[model samples]
Target: MTIQSLGVGSGLALDDLVTQLLSAEREPKEKRLNDKEERIEAEISALGQIKSKLSDFKETVDEMRRDSDINGREPTITHPSEDKDIFTAEASNSALRGSYEIAVTELASGSRIETADAAYTESTDQVLTDGLGSTTMTFKINNTGDSFTVSVTQNMTLAQLREAINNNENNFGVNANIIDTGTATGGAKLVFTSDVTGAGNDLVIVNDGDRAELDSLTTTDSTETATNLSPVKSATNAKATIDGIPVESETNEFENTIQNVSFEATSVSPLDTDGITRVTSTLEIGYDRDGLDKKIRDFVDNYNKIISDIQSLTRYGESDLEEDGALAGDSMLRGISNGLASIVGSSVDSSSLGGLFALGVELNSDGKLEIPTTDFGLGTGDERLEAALEDNFDEIAKLFTDEDQGIAVRLYEMANEYTSYSGLITLRERAAKDDKDQIADDRERFELRMVSYEQILRDRYLNLDQTVARLNQTGSALLAALG
Candidate 1:
């Protein structure tokens, strides 16, 4: 049988009374937790935003650091194949985590090309079959190497064919255009041109469509490996050495190689012709201190608030409205509340990070993570830390950022390892949230029950009022009759 509450009546059910008391006892606690969660969420979101900004800021600082070092060396970029001032450098490292040191000469020009587009069967130029003006075909472009095919309609208008050719930009290395000859009898003619300038990979028009006695050239699109680069010479031609290993260059400078070698350019290298000295460098890609602090503060405030609610529900003092709280002495709630102690002392190998502990980032007597210093300001210990970093960066990056070993990564993995209901923060947090949600559901049920009780009480009162009025009228009538 379904149970419903009768709020008030001449007679009351024991179950209804208990339920009303329970609602009063649980509502406040759930409300406390919900309010706490909102504040925590705000803090978390604020932290995330700040951290993102900080990461960018850090990248800017790093770039500045790079630029500040020997004035950012200008490097020339080039296409792989081409006969011109071409330079190359290579670096190799036993580990994956260090920056490069190079002396690069700026190239006079950098050559690049767009990948080919798809092919289609709707042609325009004299390149198409006769009487196929209304017909259309299609094809595709390949990046590594390869020419694509296209067919034009017979005697198609130059403008119409040009449109068709341009329409198949995917297959063509170049875009097509129609030129107005300006002659009274002349109309626009289709012209195909390359988007890039260079000897290698220069636009080559292939005979993909039938010439039908126009001289049938049978071949598919072929990969056009580039040749002839721009005037960017290797500075090492004069003299260069990589980590004391003497290296040779034919032109001005070497760049983008895996090796951490520096070239001693004989004179002031005119690498960047743009004369643009300062360019914004690396893009920042990590979190910052303020963001982290905000997260920490949020966790603290939220955790505290949840604690307060739990205390409110499980141990309401005499001063509280309720003498005995609804969840009082619930072992599960108390146990869950205490589970927060785990992360506070969550251990990471202090030595693994190389003097990570000496920076006033310490473990307290009670085994909690402590940063007596205001910031994760390893940057302040710049000179000494940098000196150390020069030698141990790979290890340091590994301990703090590597997916398997970094603190953040470890915490992230742990955060999702939920034994019960899954959540982001801590197990205790998950438990508290789950508890709060559960109680909130109970509160909803209680409110529904209260509505039924209110109706029953109203009806009972009405009946009593009517009965008294009837009795009064009957008594008056009897008295009059007796008189």
Candidate 2:
């Protein structure tokens, strides 16, 4: 650590200067090595952050797998408490010839006439009994009962009036029909019928004339809602069964949750219901199946990234010997790699529909896992995808979460138990904070020690320089004195 001071011309302490300079210069190198280590730790720390998010997202994907309708599609869903099993085909064979008393309520207000012809009308049998003009609408009362007429001003169309008659088949117990043409008599006439002999789904229409009743279009009253009234066609004909659920709808619009698959029928029904008519509807879902897919993709992408990063850590420094370094021998990464390799090729059990596709899954040349299906034209399928999904979803989910089969298991283990859903990111976050803290601390100590070493070296070198310079000066003085 000594420094020759002759180079200072003997005017200063050269040894001290050199020692200080040397110590200072050498110290940063060691300090820099420590800094480099901190940087590597930080890099690892950041990767861990992304890893934690992927684990949470993985659990979400697993849960949705059990609930998805399409293989990898999302849904739009709103759980509103409307009514359940509200369909009351309480309608039967007698539905065509039912009657009951009616009390109409006008939504708007004004001076009104007790429209004999304009009063309560019906569509049932209208087209059948009357000709095309009968299509104007008519209703015959099967049972007048004791029901009185509530006067109103609004004119009821054959369609509107027909709906009014059948609105509460179960509640009011009435069905209405109109004759297609004028009765053998004259004037348009509306008819009301009772599906049940007693009076279920039947009604009497009261106008401003002598009250009349026509159970079988007998034209009991001359002052009915309409006279010579035509008949409107019968009620709507709707019947369908999407998968196995029967539906009765006027149009193609219905929502049902059956067989654990959310159905959004639209203009189409997959199965025929023989006689039961259903509405055609378009099925739609929000943020469910497709959401889960995005979630799964996130998991896979993060997984691959972590694996690649770990790979680099093991064989760093461009040396053959580095190939056997820390990451290269990491058992955790090896386990994860093997786990991924297995899931990519696992097939399904196909015993259900006569082993429709004996081959469970196929890998396309594009590296996509193609699920085998029947029929292939999308009627459920040539082979039913629905059937396969029903039979195999549980097994598919196992590959993502089970200790022996799931990616999460190996991924969590690779994370050194730092990633988990049981406890929300507590361990992981601390690991990150502690890492950054260690880097800062090591950098600080390294900087301080480097400063000290430099000072010591500088002092030694300066002292040597001073000593050498003094000897030269003394030799010069001796020569002068001898002269």
Candidate 3:
């Protein structure tokens, strides 16, 4: 009764016709917008990848700028005798390269004290301080006169006192623990150890109150009335000699005793037992050539990786699919590539080693940097690098670390320009995102217009169908009268 049977009156496929017309108008615009969106997305992805590569390149450059870089002076240590556990040493770049004799006479030790074996029992619920009136226990370290206090309260167990002392905020350089002997005669003993090692740094306990319970916990040396605690070990300073010159330290580890050289006294020299009392160990400090070589090689490898990524992204190909590299024709990529190449190819001023090419790094036919293992008829490549490092070491370091014209410094600065928060890459990405947003807005408006156009087509067709039905009815009535 309604428009369901209207197709017969109109003699035309109205629904299909309207659909075809609307699709024809919408399809092309939608396809164009979708293609633009995809291109912008691809560009954003490409920028992210480029930024990552630049950051990696910057890391290598930063290493080269440091004084501790492998390209700089490297120190190597050699011990003359094997199995000399008496001592071990490390030399820094600041250390003068020389040979020195060392002797370890004694290793430093910490102060240790144990409470009298009868002080505590294995029973957890037994309160040792029940009868002990409130008292103040003071601990001093290093004879510094700086002390920490522990207030012993009534009804406190031996375990509780240990925890209170350990958890005290003011307590420094001391640790307390409860040791259970598990024997009837030796129930439990509280032990205290000085965290610091050295001759003058000793743990001293003093009881301030008249409480006998607190006085019993102090060592005999600190209090005459103290008989419940005994000193098991005395704090002692480490003793050693460099080239027969005596040296003393609070700890076994000796620092700056030999001009930028630090060492730890592990055990007494074996020569002491033989009655020789002479140097037990000899130390040699020198330049590490192999270490520097490995570092330079790693820097070259990281540089090449960055170059390869840039080349891949900017390359052009014949086929459509193969030619779709996101940054193929990007001007920003071109500028970045040119800037890096210029910096690498430039020379540092006031340096005997002019540039990387003179010191083993060379650009190949493929536009990538490579370090050849063997010299290919040119005396200027890998062989030159080794000779320069061995013969003119200072010049090689100056070439890469020169403050004004160093290649590493310039390259690091250049990378920062593109990778920084407000850099070129970030700006380009922002522009691309804006373009995508505009395209999305356009698509939304187009869809809305199509919806309104579709309704117009449906209204016009419905009116046409009704008008054609009325005309058919009139003609049938006329034919009936004529017959």
Quick one: best TM-score, which candidate? 3
Residues 220-315 of candidate 2: C-alpha lDDT, one tens digit per residue: 243453543222323231344433344443322222313223332222222225644332232232223234334445554554554455555444
Error of 2 at 259 (Å): 11
Q: How many residue pairs collide in each prediction?
A: 50, 104, 2
- lDDT tens string, model 3, 178-287? 88888878988778987767766768787666465665577533443545455688888889888788999888889888877788888787665557775457767666
> Which portions of model 2 show Cα errors greater than 4 Å?
1-6, 11-39, 42-46, 49-53, 56-60, 63-65, 68-327, 339-418, 421-436
Q: Mind giving the per-residue lDDT tens digits that candidate 1 earns over 47-93?
A: 24323432333333232222122122222333223443233422223
On a 0 to 1 TM-score scale, where does candidate 2 land against the true structure? Answer: 0.38
Give the Å shift of residue 365 in candidate 3: 3.0
Instruction: Tell how far residue 282 is off in model 3, in angstroms.
Output: 3.9
Candidate 1, after superposition: displacement of residue 216 in Å?
Answer: 13
lDDT of every model, 2 decimals: 0.39, 0.40, 0.76
Q: Ranking under TM-score, best-scoring first?
A: 3, 1, 2
Q: Each prediction's TM-score against the native?
A: 0.43, 0.38, 0.85
* Better by TM-score, candidate 3 or 2: 3
Q: After aligning candidate 1 to the native by TM-score, how far in Å is the CA of 86 from where it should be?
A: 13
Query: Which candidate number has the best lDDT?
Result: 3
